[model samples]
Target chain A: MFFHIILERNMQLHPRHFGARLREKLVSKLIKDVEGTCSGRHGFVVAIMGIEHVGKGLIRDGTGFVTFPVKYKCVVFRPFKGEILEAVVTMVNKMGFFAEAGPVQIFVSNHLIPDDMEFQSADTPNYTTSDGSVKIQKDTEVRLKIIGTRVDATEIFCIGTIKDDFLGVISDPSAAV
Target chain B: MSGEEEENAAELKLGEDFVKAKCLMNGEVSLILDRRLEQLQQLSEDPLNQMPQVFEKSLQYVKRFSRYNNPDAVRQVREILSRHQLAEFELVVLGNLCPETVEEAIAMVPSLKDKGRGLDDEAIEKMLTDLALIKSSSSSGHLLKKLGFGLASL
Candidate 1:
């Protein structure tokens, strides 16, 4: 879900960034520093929307660097219990396959997979049905529901299930969906 | 297994070899075996080796049983049904099939119908529901359709 909430971060600037493009440097630095990083409180920082207000830069005593408190609006992606998400398969194994919806890594345990789909050990491990159809392998796009999630300092690990109705593969990437 | 079931099991022994081969092709134990076979197939069929014919039949077996081979699914079913009083093989069947309805669950344990209010009849239903394994009969065609397995006929 996208939120227009404001977030505060302490941004430091080098002496070289004190010239005409100081604000541009600060915004670009903010995007690079925050995007893709997760917080225990919020979720994954998707994109920096706008600068709410940059606090007056405070110069350090001996280092001569300026530290400014920057407030900005950003979009964050967070997976909640029961939230359905479409993700791309990253890796497939005997346990199950791991998928990523942006920054969130979801694990759909074979237990949580529909019983008809069985795990196959091939050059590329995949889950397929008895008829050699409905194969889920690397790069396959899947729709799954988050049953359980554990958000860490930098990453979100989720236990998802595709066994439910309307949850599973969306389309094969090779088929271009 | 009951008296009649025992006789059926004995009768099944006649096709023991055929059954074992079929199981290895598409049963729970094949899940692990298939993984190894896949790796071996890839290695043996390398650019230099190019000897895939060595396990060509096995490759087809792995493909056929790929979906029915997972032991983890059985393990999960076992964990969920451990509270109930049931035999090991019965649990295996339940794990493998993962019946999606109360009617189907009962079908898996049809012997229970004769026992008159057999052990927590509602447990299986609740378990399947809670695990989100029940196929939504009402929805019909959806995910399976996108995968080329339409539900129109079913």
Candidate 2:
């Protein structure tokens, strides 16, 4: 899921960048520092939409650096338990397949896949149904429910399942064309 | 930690922080990214090349999954879904998936069927129908544009 929420950060600026483009420097620095970083509480920060506020700079006596509190609105992608997500399959193996829904990595174990589908080992690995009407392989889009999530300081890993109704292959790159 | 509560979509238990946060539909995310991309293009000589990996992947995901491409259609989807008195999370899920049947919608986000929510099968059907109409109208308009371009090229 994606959220547009306001977040606050204290930015440190070197005294050399204190001139006319101070605001520009701060905004660019914030983008460089914040975007792509993940926190346990906020998930992944995809982009900095806009800067809400920049507090007065407080100079540090030792290093000639200044700290300014910055508030910004950003788009974050956080997968929650029981939230349905559409993800692209990236790999397939005997144990399970690894899929990516943006920054989050999900593993849908073989057991969690509907029992009818069997894994086919080949040059292009995939899980296919008996009749072969349905297939899950690299690049296939699937809608799966996140059964669990592990949040690290810089990453999030999810355990997903497609065993439930309305959850399974959404689109196949091979078949679509 | 108690933070890892078992929140189920069936009852719309989306944890504490998430329950109040503003949820963005796929289309809205795409729109916001598109505008940001344009801003980057205007500001720098080479823009996309410097984009963060997260931004690039998110841009691709949202652009591919967004059901409605036009701003007007995006706004209309929110407007139409909001009328059903859906929570932000539910609204975005319904908008993103565009489920064809009430059953599918309920299966996808079961909170819509919670007894206390007071939504019935018929009302859910009506909502799905309205969403489908928006999708069809927008897609047909897209098809017409493609046809016009083809004709002009010939």
Candidate 3:
């Protein structure tokens, strides 16, 4: 899920960038520094929506650079256990398949797939139902339930399952073609 | 991250931080990101190289999955769903998936089936109908554009 929330950060600015457009410099620098970064606590910071506050600059005794405490609102994506998500399949293998829901990567192991759908190893590897009516391959969109999540400083990985009722391939790019 | 359990817990255990934060639907994110892209293009000649990986992936994901593309339709969809008094997470999930039946909706969002919740099957069915109505109307609008009738009509 995507969230719009305010987060605080301490930004250091060089003496050379302390001219007429100080706020502009700070905003741009904040975007460059903060966007795409992930933290275990808050998940991935996708974009900086707006700056809520910039506290008084505190300068060190020796260095001429100024440190400013900036509070800004941003959009973040995070996945939680038991949360249902729709993700696009990126790869398929014998063990399982990897699908991505925005920045979060989820793995649905062979045990998580329904029993009827058997993995077929061919030129185009995929998991197909007995009747071949339902197929999961590259670019297939699936609705899955996250059973567990591992959050690291820079990334989050999830173990998802499509074995539950109403959780399976939602769209097949191949069928559309 | 600490907060009231009632306020923070969506049927699913979204952590305290996520529950407190305002949730955005795929359609809303797509709109916000599209505007940001336009601004970035105006700012520099080679902005794509400067784009963050997260932003790039999210933009593509939302654009591909967002059910309501137009701002008016997005607003209407929100208004219709908001009337049902759903959790922000549930509302967005329903909006994103656009399930066809009450059983499917309840299945997609199991919280709706939980006891003590006032949302009954009839209400769920009504909400699905309203959502489907908007979806069909918007899709047909796109169909017209694809058929070249939209440009001629304009």
Candidate 4:
């Protein structure tokens, strides 16, 4: 009788033990859920939800709420001062040709065109320039090295020089192509 | 194994007694050597040999750590190590055990204060804080440390 009475008293003193155990189980499940979602992923999709100043949203991933900080990867490209880059001709004008490569676009002045090429006019195609030195057509590949950059209110102008190895027509069928 | 033990064995074999002296001063020579051995063990057990690049470079780092005095050498090694993809386990193990030689290499680089006669401390502090935040928020802290930023500050 005394042993039974003592057992009952111990159980009464620790009445919250069962609830605590249940809570622990729930927390463990939450951790696993979070870890399963966030682990081994290359990128994250963030959802912003709020009215004004009061914003409440959960970060969904393997990294739990406790580990609030997450890592992100960004690509940054820095070109050398005189390094040559291959680009595609986007537009042609009497002054020059516009070429783009990666995140930069450059204008090659008419004077910079190879000496052997001759510029011709056509109604259907608009304008054409061809020289044995450079075979340039619509969407022709050319190499240009950045000479200067100017940032203005309207647009950023990148000036480039079109002379050097791997700087000319890359799509010529007669050449290595 | 710890990083210090690996350092000793690699250093002894490479005949880099100079590094040993610096390690002694820092009281971390043993830890570094032991971690080096541990890395070797981990590499041997790795199934895909995904760690060969990391291991090879780590061995080179240990060897160079013994000889590194000038900032140029440190910068070179840091660049090489930063290119490779290292596992989290390897990173965690290696990040904790930087060699005294690397510390010396960092010291050799001219501080921002020494770059000019007068400088704004606020700008420098902001720059340092930004860099620190970037480092801490990065997934690969090991890569940052390999690039020669002291781990203590991180």
Instruction: For candidate 2, write residues B17-84 as lDDT tens digits.
Output: 66667999988999998999999999899887898888889898898777788999999999999999
Model 3: lDDT equals 0.82
* Candidate of highest DockQ: 2
What's the TM-score of each model vs. the native?
A: 0.48, 0.90, 0.89, 0.30
The 0-to-1 C-alpha lDDT of every candidate, in the order given, reads 0.57, 0.85, 0.82, 0.35
- Which numbered prediction scores highest in TM-score against the true structure? 2
Tens-digit lDDT track of model 4 for B19-44: 22111200122223345457557658
- Can you rank all candidates by TM-score, best first? 2, 3, 1, 4
Supply candidate 1's per-residue lDDT for A97.
88
State in Å the error of residue B110, model 3: 1.8
> In model 4, what is the error at residue B45, expressed in angstroms?
44
By summed lDDT, the worst window of 10 consecutive residues in model 1 chain B runs over: B16-25
- Residue-level lDDT of model 4, residues A1-177, one tens digit each, is 000000000001122333546434333333232211211111111111111121222444663332212221111122223334456677776676787643345787777765555555443121333534445656776546555555443234567765533345644423221
Positional deviation of residue A95's Cα in model 4 after best superposition, in angstroms = 0.9
Order the numbered candidates by lDDT, best leading.
2, 3, 1, 4
Better of 3 and 4 by lDDT: 3
- Comparing 1 and 3 on DockQ, the stronger one: 3
Instruction: Calculate DockQ per candidate and list them.
Output: 0.02, 0.51, 0.45, 0.02
Model 2 iRMS (Å) reads 2.4
